[model samples]
Target chain A: MLADIEEFYRLDRLPHIWCPGCGNGIVLACLVKAIKELKYDQDKTVVVSGIGCSSRASAYLDFNTLHTTHGRALAFATGIKLAKPELNIFVITGDGDSSAIGGNHLIHAARRNIDLNVVIFNNNIYGMTGGQYSPLTPKVQKATTAPYGTIERPFDLAKLVEAAGATYVARSTAYHTRLTTELIINGAKNKGFSVTEVISQCPVSYGRRNRFNTPAAMLEWQREMAVPVIKARSMAPEELEGKIITGELYRGHAPEYVSEYTKLTQRLKEEAEGV
Target chain B: MPKDPANIGKPEVAIKDSWCKGCGICVALCPKKVLVMNAQGKAVVACPEKCVGCKMCAEHCPDYAITVEVE
Candidate 1:
């Protein structure tokens, strides 16, 4: 098993930290494969993360990474890209980190249409600080904090990003490893801000409390909820209601953050010269 | 001959002793012989050089204690 892992993974760093059956490790594998396939300059690529189990992604990759403050990976990444526009920036964040405390930053980053790739690991709970309810946790899902079941409705990450003006928005799950990796790789290649919300499983916290007894059972739930975007659109609102739509939801041409900022710099230079 | 000499480096693993309940599952599951129990019986990296970051400890930890941080 380890031999197979070493062939594609960083073998020296064996025995990862993710709990048994946790989906974060799978997501990490997908990300690493995507990076390798793209063959991007490791020196020019930066992986930024906030506090959470998923945030550990920054430390694992052999690239320029920034482990920033909670809910602030986007802010730090924005500054980094604005300072050095040539770098390829990737943000790895968990559901709680991106949508709850960092919700404002997430929407604003998309609205600005920055040239950053964001991978949202939506496990529906706060796995690091104990299993607590997250913004993406479905209504009535039980969490450590919501022992009686969560009453509040959940946030639709893809719709939120699309409405915020993200140039590309897609959804995938750890269950769909190949497709998830493809979405991440394509998101990286997209010029304007691209976001992929990966609805993953947190067996220890999210699953155990929500009545998912085993990892396999939890994965089955994801499979059931996911509906292809094309099929979903053809169905009426009644038919599509309650179904989780997966695939590329929205893609449009938009000016990247760097190009827009470049125009600003050129204008400033011309004004200074005239003065 | 050394197999890709430049590829050799330190082993990596995500250690969260606080999350470890000393269940010893990781010790039993890791095929690389990488994890070991410390004085308190919590899982620790004993032969990390043998580790391949296969994520066995993380995927198996019932407590969500560890997350592999590779470099």
Candidate 2:
């Protein structure tokens, strides 16, 4: 409805290349709005992503952006954060890009507790690569590779990152757009590593392969499956079966890697001068 | 120019036609039934007066095509 245009978006890329019902656009909007609400200096903020459907978000965002190689977005982002800790870095990675080929980078980054805001677009399948089953693909969810359905259990990325040492972690769906934005805002505010895993829909890749006839149906499924963190606590484990627990899953204090590295260098500099 | 007559004093729910992909997300998610997909499939405000300015349609629009101003 913006008559002029969203200042945060690249005018040349007015209409994004995402599929008609793909939730990538919604997640991208959430990320940008979160950045706006935080009043971050656009010039100081950097958006990075690896190759995939969701990674294309960097092309539309009007900021210091990077389109890195496959599954290595976190590695590139970590290097950037180390080089220029003052700039706000946001990684826009897909489930496959973050959890499959780049899985090791994901764990190490969370383990380091670096000050980077990561937003994983968990669309389940490897959409850009033509519907291959990714690591986060829910168990028994059909993909092109898994003609019937995936047999392996999917990783609960929020729990994975929390255990790996992320200071803040949250999971939200594209249907819950406002909640996704709010989680990103809080995650960005966290001092250490923050992960906001958005359960975005891949209507073309994941839906058609499965039984979700329309994107609306998938959205409704998300609505039915999502249970807030506060509400989930009271329900018994059995009652939570098949329900996705969303909201702030974890928030803890930790020594940020960047600051610790800076401290080490400063101490060495003082010691050298004293000698 | 074909604004619904009932929209006289309603909060504006403006939608950019060019950007809309007709995903129907805004229409389905609009709790007030204030939006509908026109014949061409772009979303239009059917009853702007019912808009509580929650921005459900605006915020959830995948194409970033909807906007609402309560004031």
* DockQ of the two-chain complex in candidate 1: 0.07
Question: In model 2, where do residues sit more than 4 Å from their true spots?
Answer: A1-5, B1-9, B48-50
**Which digits, one per residue and each the tens of the lDDT, describe model 2 over residues A1-275?**
44333898887886888887889988888898899999999999999999899999999988999999998999999999999999999999999999988989999999999999999999999998799999998899899999989999998888889889999999999889889989999999998899999998999999998999877878889989999999999999999987889999999998999999999999999999999
What does candidate 1's lDDT look like per residue over A1-275, in tens digits? 22223344434444557776677766777776677778778788889999899997676666788999999999999999999998989899999899988999999999899999999988999998998898888888899889999999999988898898899998988767677888988998899899998888888988888788767567667778889898988889888766778888889788787899999999999999999
Candidate 2 lDDT over B1-71, as tens digits, reads: 76567666567888888888988888888889998989998788888778888887776677778888665
Which residues of candidate 1, in runs, are more than 4 Å off?
A: A1-13, B1-71
Please provide TM-scores, in order, for all candidate models, with all chains considered together.
Answer: 0.77, 0.94
Error of 2 at A254 (Å): 1.7
How does each model score on lDDT? 0.80, 0.89
